[model samples]
Target: MKINNLKNLFKNNFVKNIFFVSSGTAIAQIIGTITYPIITRYYTPDEFGVFVTYSSIIAILSIISSLKYEFAIPIAESEEKAVNIVFLCVGILIIYSSIIFLALLLYSNEIFSLLGNEHLNQYWYLIPIGVSFIGIYSLFMYWSFRKKEYLAISKTTISQSFFGNISKIGFGFLNMGAFGLIFGDILGKSAGITVLSKSFINNKCFSKANLSEIIEQSKRYIKFPIYSAPSKLLNTLGVQLPVIFITLLYGSSVAGFFGLSHTIVSIPMSLIGTSVGNVFYGEAASIGRKNPKKIKELSNNLLKKLIAIGIIPLITLILFGPILFKFVFGSNWYQAGIYAQIIAFLVFFRFMFTPITNIFSVFERQKEELYLDSFRLVLVLIAFGISKYVNLDSFWAIGLYSLAMCIVYFVTYIYAQKILNDEIKKI
Candidate 1:
């Protein structure tokens, strides 16, 4: 009887889908994990700082490149509408990236000076290129999600990780400095586009998308741009702003340490949280319309499971984060481990809340997310302000930041539960 139950569990589609996605992410993260030690040896913290700052800029811009219309792809009512949304996203990406490139070309020095990292002025052109690649990859990845093409998505994840990491190591050997890290990242972002594009061509999705349909769908999903895009931009700001602040206040080496710690701590989030979140988003959207109560049940169960999964990592980091960083990354990165310990609480809560928060988009309750994310960003700024006011070191500033974010994410978890309850009551 137990064996039969186990076999049946394996046959379940949701479990199967998550397995495929998570396996790919697991392999990709493993490759990255193996290469980090080597990469760290070749590049200094200052170089890593520069790379992190450049990445932060790209990440913030990429959030709104399509005005977040790609988010509507999975929950779109029909294949035709979904395909049109993809074209809509790609079109917006081209225009947005072009604008960014032109702006940088004309105002590179002024912008870099404002950012307090004029070192980026030399590579200003790469900003738009990075944003474009990231935007394209995201839109297609969602299309894959809508089609239930988990295996294809998995292959692309592996391809991205393998090629990107290999190139980073190769460039490190050539002593290419921060530019190597930036270019390698751009290469990784581009690697998956070709494979994702095949799905579009094979399905004749390209021919189906027309300007009229694109405009119609854009209006149909206008809320995504109006509410979801800005909300997501603020959320990205909450995540990426610290790097800028650290760079401005403490310098590149400190930002590098912070960046490395963030990278290491976010591994579980990338590996499991994102994989499960993608699958959960697809599944929840399917189930949510028919049974709002089921969404509540599903979210509660996921929260419990996430808490269990996160506790071990949290405890491990608290106890031995610095030691582990010294041992695994290098002795020079000992400070990063200290930062990791400080932020582990935030990462843990983030891992739990992030996957489940798709309930907002699933139900079109983006305004609540916008409001909450606004508050979250404010809290982050307050943390930084307090740290700066008190003249604390980067370590203390990060601690205050983590503590503040933990409170907001916990509130977000509660609020998400309430959103689910409110939906259930409406039924």
Candidate 2:
């Protein structure tokens, strides 16, 4: 009877959305994990380092190409302009990456020297090669979210994963090295875009997204790209700082361990937390605007769910990380167990905090969200610096970093709850 009641309780849109988003990505990540062993067997740490570097550069470029507008698109008032903003972001990314490509061509050696690795210098060519299509897919994704098309969202993710696995294995066998991963990344995104493009672009929603509307919409959130560009750049740098520190202090080998362990451990977050957070953002925004009274209720409900559902993955990682890494990804990845546990405990804090952070967008608390993220930025910097100077192991540094973040999350939740209460009292 109790189990039946619990099932009935999750019948609402929010619960269904969470299930839809999470199940698809969770399955996709599992497939991605399965493919890891295949590639890891063929690639050396140094070769894998190339994959890591190029992937990171592509990630950074995607962010730059995005101009952070995707994050802000939901907040825009005009749906038409929001539609155009998607393409606008795409146009800007292509233009920006093209310029970057030209410059890299002119100063390949100088750029490689800047990265401290000549090998990584050539991968810059892959930037324009794949980023254009991938960038388009990213912007279109925001459009899907803004339109509340969760099922389409789920389908795209599944197709991307399926194609990604096929292309990765096929290309990896061709002796293409890191290019295989790059191809997998680009082709996956391109496939997703192609699948979803017709529905999104042809919808009545975007019909209103003509040039005049684009200008007005662009004007509305120009500050986003401006402040957000460098903010996101710094934030990405902050994320990768540990990897950079690992390389500087310990060399490419340890950095490989760091990257691999980070990836393996971050699975729960990348799969579950991100999937849930994606839906939560759109859901919170919808409720805040239409059903203002439900904000706290939804927020608290999400916190409980995150804790409950999140624990299963955490236990799996803590228990099976070493064995799985050793057998599947080879003995070298055994250290993944230790790092996975540390990262999971850290991600646990993140999982709890994610829904609350989304509430910031709920009540139009963008500034407050920015402030909290800034606080988090500071904590990440301090932790990274200490780890670097004191020469802490990757385990210790990551744990410290996660601990600082957990503290910030709890404090922010307390404060946001209080403010929410005060606002409700006046009602």
Candidate 3:
């Protein structure tokens, strides 16, 4: 009886989207999870580790590659103008990312020397190309959100995961190793881009807003990308910084394990935390103009629900992480499993409060997020330094590293809670 009632409640729009988003993410997760085993069979842990490190760097570098335009798309005036804004942002990104890539090519030798990773030298060739693809793909996803095309949004991701990981499997079978993983990822983006290009051409959003209006509104809007973009990017970097440090201090294999664990943990996060937050952004962005009190009400409820959803999985993982890791991911990724468990636990704090902090964006608090993000960056450096000196293992490094980020989330959540309350009072 209770189970049936719970199911009924989730049928509501708010809950329904969460479930649907998570379901799609689950499908993607399964594809990626299956690929890991084949990848393990073919690549040495060391090789996998190098790829992992490069991937993390790529993830962080992605922030620079994209120039933080995705966040801008949703807040634009209308669907049509949003399309124009996105294309403009993409144009800016192309110019900058191309320059960076060429510079990287010219300075590749110096970079490898400074970074001190011989394996990384091989991956450097892909970085420039990866940046452009990542930037384009990001805009495509954001465009999906701007148009409220959730089904298309979900399908794109599911397809990307399926084809990308499948490519990895074939590559591993052919002894392509980590390069296969990189190629698989690139191919998935390329595939997604083709799909996006077709949809974009047909979509009438391009007819809605003119370039001048977009430029005007960009200057006028509360959620300008200049600040919001870097904050969002830093948030991603803060999470992945551990992999960078571990790669430098210990090696890429440890980096691989860290990346592997972080990727798995991020599944639930992307499915639940990110999905709901994205919806909330769309819902709450205009609440300040209409009814700010409603934003408070929604955020409070979301925090409660997010906490409830996070707790059981975290506790379960903590108790059985080692067993699950060994059983599920092959022997090579026991470390990955353990890291996932720790990260899951750490994520409890993060997931518990992300929704509330996200409300700040509705109120134009990107600067506040930047301040908190700055603190997180410092803590990341400290955590990395300590781990390097004390020689912590990969899983623990992953855990301790994320612990600092949790602090930022909690702080932001508290302030956002207060800000929403004040807005309610004003109303």
Candidate 4:
């Protein structure tokens, strides 16, 4: 009877939506988990380093590719308004990507040379292509979130993983090196576009998006471009800069090890954190105006659940990360496991706090988020700078980085709680 009651509780709409997204993310992660060992064997750490550098650049750029107006879609007032926001995001994405492409063409030599990775010069064109695909996918993703099409989103996740992983293996066999990894990623990102586009084309709401409406919505949500975009960009930079710094300072091989560790640690974030965040954002947006107290309740419940779900895996990694990495990804990757151990606690805090921090956006507190993200970036730079000053090894540098991030995430969690409490007080 107790088990049946628990099952019924899990069947609620919020839980069901999380299940749809998480199950899809789980399948996608499982595919990567199974293939990563093979991938590690096929690509040397140096190659992985180059791939990570390219990916980090793309990730930082993609954060603002649409100037973050797509984020307004889920919280927009009406279907018509949301549709216009999507169109606005698309227009901005095209212009932003084109600008990036032109800039790269004019300065590819200098950019690649500064990064100390001449290998990326030949593949510079793919950066803009990647930004476009990621930006478009994000626009569609938020639209699906608004419509509560979790199943469609899930399907796209699975398709992307399947195609992307298979392509990576194929390209690796061809010995295309980092280009193969980069191209495979591009393929994976593009794979789900057709599936996600169906929601837009089939809905009559899209036709409501006119030039005037787009302009109106753009101004209406002007804070997204003004504040949210920079916040998100800084957040991404805080995450991706380590990879770039490691590549520049310790060399690509060390960066590759760190990248692999970070990837493995981030699986839980991708699998559960993102799923919960999507559902939470959708639900919170709906309830934010009507019943703000419920947002507090929901956030508290999610924090507890995230803590319980994350503790065991993170603890296991901390204790046995090196062993697992060696056994799974081969002996050469043993160092990656050590890096994972150093960052496991950081990932735990991140996994617990990151999903719920969407409340910042939910409450339209983009400036606060921007401030926190700026603090995070400053801390990261200091951590790396201190490491270089002392000539600390990669492990110690990562440890310092991890400590800084843990502090920031904890502060973020407290701030989110304060925001929720303050919202309730206003009533």
lDDT of 2 by residue, 1-427 (tens): 9999878967888888888877788877877777778877766666556566666666666666777777666656667667777767766887887887898899978866665556776566777767777777777776667777777778788888778767877887887776676677677767778655666657765555577766776677776676666655655655665565556555666666667777766665656777777787887666655554587787777788788977887898788877877888888777756677667776676677655665554564555555665776788789878988888876787778767767766877787787678667767
lDDT of 3 at 355: 56
Using TM-score as the measure, name the better of candidate 1 and candidate 3.
1
The model with the greatest lDDT is 4
List candidate 3 stretches off by more than 4 Å: 1-11, 64-66, 194-199, 204-211, 221-223, 286-288, 389-396
lDDT of 1 by residue, 299-397 (tens): 788778888988999999999999999999888899999999998998998898888888889989889999999999999999999888999999889
lDDT scores in order: 0.90, 0.71, 0.71, 0.90
Candidate 1 runs further than 4 Å off = none
Ranking by lDDT: 4, 1, 3, 2
- Estimated TM-score for each candidate: 0.98, 0.88, 0.89, 0.98
Q: Could you tell me how far off, in angstroms, the CA of residue 338 lies in candidate 3 after the best superposition?
A: 3.2
Count of clashing pairs, candidate 4: 0
How do the residues 1-427 of candidate 3 rate in per-residue lDDT, one tens digit apiece? 9999998897766566656656666787787777766666777767777677667667777775545656767766666666767767677777877777787778877876666466667677687677778788778777766666666666666888888778878888898877887877777765567555556778655676477866665566535466776787777777776766777777777677767666666666645676678777766764444587777778778877887878887887788876777777788778777777777766777768775677666677778787777777888888888777888866566667778777777887888888777777876
Model 2: colliding residue pairs: none
